[model samples]
Target: MGLNSAMATVPTKEKGSDEIDFVRWFSQLEGNLAETLNGVLLRAARPVQVGAASGAQNLASTSAGRLVGWSLREATGTAPGVVRIWDGRDNGGALLACVNLGQGASETQWMAPGGVSFQHGLYVEIITGAGLSDDVEGAVYLGGAE
Candidate 1:
């Protein structure tokens, strides 16, 4: 028997597409005093929300990129603990868009197709109660396969 044949190896597969998985997280800080700190992200195909107490996540396709995971826990607070995402690249700086949730207090939608005329740098700010400050957290994710 030859000793050269005793070595073992694991085969690796290559990605068929030039796709990559990426992710980022932000947190609501301890004492974040928001009645609802929206996590707005700009998508081109409207993402989907998951679970209760949380908001829509993602429904994205790479205009030229992959759909990674999420980037959460960048803040801390009362934590509305919601994440509402959308498409068309205009969810404010908000990790998630509030408009998509639809009618927390309305019979009709606030807008059509895309809500709130999103600008290039419309910052997604928090909406907490008066005279209170706490922390909150959330994340964004990206992923695609070949």
Candidate 2:
């Protein structure tokens, strides 16, 4: 069964406490706990390679949520390249983040700091400079309630 299904099996019981409804309190607590746990698990999901390109490429499109983090790796053995994350369909929109990869095989990771969130429902763009012999591979991490 799924996590939500398992969480649904939790029993709610009523308890007398002066003028308070302990059953409702417990139910709400369980729901909050489950949601928190689910968020953590979602953030821990494996990264997926959006795409690889020699020039500018549209890496991925989000589903109306804040991008929390990302991991990028240069798959080709050519010169280093720059990867930029945009907030729109093309690279002409607002720039959200950028990462510089070293020459040859190299990797890097990024995470949004506290009190910062990327725009919702936007597209991430990856761009590389000249001398790219092979395509670049990378993945992005997204979070927030959608």
* Top candidate by TM-score: 2
lDDT of each: 0.30, 0.54
Q: What is the lDDT of residue 61 in candidate 2?
A: 53
lDDT of each residue in 1-146, candidate 2, tens digit only? 41322222333455432343556667666554432344553323234455473443354554334566666666666677677777766676678877777665556554553322545444655564466424556676654332
lDDT of 1 at 125: 28
lDDT for model 1 comes to 0.30
Task: Tell me the tens digit of each residue's lDDT in model 1 across 53-116.
Answer: 1563233322323223333332333333333444344443334354211112111122323333
Model 2 segments beyond 4 Å from truth?
A: 1-46, 53-59, 112-116, 132-134, 144-146
Best by lDDT: 2
TM-score of each: 0.24, 0.55
User: Cα RMSD for candidate 2?
Assistant: 8.4
